[model samples]
Target chain A: MIKTKKIHKEIETLITGAGTILISSHVDPDGDSLGSQLALRRYLVSLGKKVWIVNHGSIPSKYMFLPDIDRIVRIDNFKSEDRFDLAIILECPDPGRTGDVKHLIGANMPMINIDHHPDNSGYGKIAHLDSGASAVAEMLTEYFLEVGYKIDDPAATQLYTAIITDTGRFRFSSTTRKTMEVAGRLIELGADPRYISDNIYYSFSESTMRLIGKVFSKFELFDNGKICLMALDNDMMRLNDFNSADTEGMAEYTLFGRGVIVGGLLKEMGEGSTKISLRSRNSINVGEVAHRYGGGGHNNAAGFQIDLPLKAAQEKILKDLREIVNGTV
Target chain B: MIKTKKIHKEIETLITGAGTILISSHVDPDGDSLGSQLALRRYLVSLGKKVWIVNHGSIPSKYMFLPDIDRIVRIDNFKSEDRFDLAIILECPDPGRTGDVKHLIGANMPMINIDHHPDNSGYGKIAHLDSGASAVAEMLTEYFLEVGYKIDDPAATQLYTAIITDTGRFRFSSTTRKTMEVAGRLIELGADPRYISDNIYYSFSESTMRLIGKVFSKFELFDNGKICLMALDNDMMRLNDFNSADTEGMAEYTLFGRGVIVGGLLKEMGEGSTKISLRSRNSINVGEVAHRYGGGGHNNAAGFQIDLPLKAAQEKILKDLREIVNGTV
Candidate 1:
């Protein structure tokens, strides 16, 4: 608690001291990054400070419903003449994750690194990184509470979106008692959970829905149903007009089968290369498996690329996965 | 709040005064009904009370992981000689909803009707009905808190499951600040949210996954993409070895498309009959549509049956749905 208070004080000092603020997060901004950026921007703007939210990538269509979403400017659209008194880098492990936004930040510029990732490199002059937080938005909510700032409805909704998406709607292990409490408070502050969830989860393109169907239909189980794999080849993608970005979260579907311990999604990335994403349910560390295959991730979720055709990649990876499942079971 | 306190006192008195208790919920038990029963039974059992959880239907395979779920007896296995000092009917609007369990309760026996449904008929001797609550488990959590009872881990898990499933993981409009607060407290009491969600959502049978894929693949859009329909005929079911129960939540998939205002699922029920489930996103009342076809439900979700083949039913329902969409949009 004391540590949180100390960090909140440091962040408050930075915010109060700044006249013009710049906010950005990692490339391919997710709900957490976008939400955290918008939420903090809303607060800073409310304080009569000039706030600019510049990001490397355009916001995903699903998250376009977030309040003040139009205010987020892409790196291509950001004017080079723009400057800031302070920069707040959110949910980024390192400044490099901010892409071209880093180039805009001059050396010696005061930066506040706000993140929940444990490996955050502590790149800023002041940092408030809580590894235990479900999302950077959770940390921001704590900071707002500590500084006695009343979070308005729009900011509450944005923060709530960040928390829900990052924690997988509170089903992820990172979801703590504090996360739920923060979400509850957000709801009280006028964050409509149903509205936000409807927009984020229910709005799917027709092609995307068809792609999901095709992908799910091809799901294969091996090693006595302990290892499940869902492979999407170029043919399936072309037929459905699927974008690679739509493959997000599809890897988790592999673990939906009853006995599945290790699940994987193999995407044919063209040029005889296959990108594989793996998720594990139990003690089997998929990260080690990914590492052995020149990829890295957390124990439960990991990924690696194989320089083989989809069919050959499946055949080769299944042997190793089978051996692992056999050894574990 | 005062009403809640008064009912809490009444419930406490009834609970303390009873030595042997009987618990049951509506037929075709859901997570809310099952979770509420188990949580209540756990608390009562901890108090040294002899509790019998006799339900009209068997527990679903997905909920088998709930702690002490084996203790719940199907109405067929309920002992004829068993008696109860008090009967607690949960989530049931009327005595008839309990099926044969209603026959087991003596006419003079004290009963508690605990429910969150607005139309609960006030069947029992002492009823505690709060329509505002997300689930019966939410009401029970309030009761436990009001009575100063320490919710154990197992009960906390049960209650947490009840809240999540009923509130659609806190995404449903029924979810409130109190619901999330109670869920937070449950986590603090040792309920593992990830474990519960995994067991409830991610543990899909291979056959069910295939069925879902097939269903999604077959989804049809009409009326300028405002109406979506997914039909499952006998061939699809037989091919996938699909159970009718697996159709649960499949109707929601119809509304997943971006422009979809109304969605319907048509299932072949044999004997030249088809069952149609409908879900709506906006002001179009699906219940009214269902009522036109001799069925009933709420505004957003409803269902009805037709003495027609799946194809015929689809054509017939699509016309009406098209008119409804055209009229509204």
Candidate 2:
């Protein structure tokens, strides 16, 4: 018996009692972060509360179509005189995950932390964290429904995007019966699944497509196809006019090959440095490998930056991956 | 005003009264058709009824991991003396859609037609057609739940696959609130979304990945990027050791480029023949264009064959696609 109902009531009371609210989420905001921020902002605005969404990073081009996306402002633009009675941070394990937005909040101001990360730091005054929830938007949607808050069409679409993307279109193990039920309710409230999907997935730029083609064509399999490696050097990025943002979700493509237990994407970040993103299946913990290289993430997906050239980084990572495949690591 | 409950009762009575049953779906079975057939067969088997699933085509390699996929035998294996008292055809608009399996059914045998296609011919003694439904699996899940029939783990998994694939992982316009709710119920009944999605999506062969790379690398955009085209010749297929089945779902990749309203895939068959698969968005009905070439499909997707070389076929289709982009045809 989790006290989820009591937590929801407390969060609701915090929202209603506040006059001015500031909302923020983790940096490098993906679909889940941006969607949850916008959905929560929309709902709070509907309650006639003065609300502002400030984030450390700019919105990605792919997520620009989200409703009220423009409402999110950069942390650099925060005014010193602006005071918030309450702060609602979503999808962040701790205040540091919100990046520079934490500096704008007064030290004594109450913070409402809503997150679904298993490692949430529980730093806020009223923290409502559920690792079982698929996404922060899932937690928010549940709270809204439990407290009888009307989720309008825009808010519903935003939450729907958050759930689908975070749960990998509801195919992730984190997705629950409650996730699907909330998504269904969002649909009833006017979230057009086709419209949102087309905007998020079908709007890839030509450069991104070409980059993907090049990357896929050059992918190499190792350890009898148990380990798959894909690289994006600086030259490939410059040639295709690609940027770091375009490589956001390409890590998943490495695991598409059959019999691939561990997949890695080696990205050359100029100089002698390389960034490696790893994905694994069959209970192989890539996060442990990432930790060995001073990186941290979930068991299935993780990344790290190395002070080595692309070739050197590949060799090092492949050695470890091979050991892991052989069950010797 | 709808009599769905009454229809469910009639279908229930029909199921309970049947001694021996045969389950089948449209030829060239996809996830929805195969899943619906398997789910229905499993449910009937639980009822102590002898149920056999006979299909016209073999299951695709990607769907071989489905629970009890081996239970679905090809039509060639049906014995002459194997007569069934009740024939339940799923996802088929008409008997012809079932191919040779329809020939084995006795003329006087009672047939139950279950489909979600708008063009259903209503060619059964008891037809339950609802175009609004996302998939036949959705309809069956609803029926089973309503009649208090237990959906075992295998049946639930099959139904979940059918719903996800038919709805494009819940991103298609056909998906509705009811679809999500039913999917939630299936999840509660032991459907593992991650396992099903992994088997259905992430099990691509090496040749398939190489083929996709080549296709994506050579894709072309016309008419200010609104029309995108990709081609696969025999030489390319042979070089990659690929077959026709490898091209499954490749048509969707054509529409992935930003601003692409019309997308087409041209495959060079032997003897100077070509087959074209077309996809469109923003209400640009590709079916109408396919009809001009004597092919047929739904509004957003369609296909046809032309008696010309790859280059000539590309030229001819490009001309029509240009006109379609200009709204002239």
Specify the highest-lDDT model's number.
Answer: 2
- Over 4 Å off in model 1, which ranges? A270-275, A282-299, A302-329, B282-284, B287-298, B302-309, B312-329
lDDT string, candidate 1, A77-182, tens digits: 9875757889999988889878898988889889999988776888899988888899999989888888887899999999999998888789878888888999
- Candidate 2 steric clashes: 0
Error of 1 at B28 (Å): 1.1
10 residues in a row with least lDDT, candidate 1 chain A: A240-249
DockQ measured for candidate 2: 0.79
Best by DockQ: 2
- Ten-residue stretch with the least lDDT total in model 1 chain B: B240-249
Cα miss at A158, model 2 (Å)? 1.0
lDDT of 1 at B305: 87
Model 1: residue A102 alpha-carbon error in angstroms? 2.1
Candidate 2 chain B weakest ten by summed lDDT: B240-249
lDDT of 2 by residue, B37-150 (tens): 999988898899998899897777878878898889889987747668899999988898788888878989999999998888998879999999999999999999888888
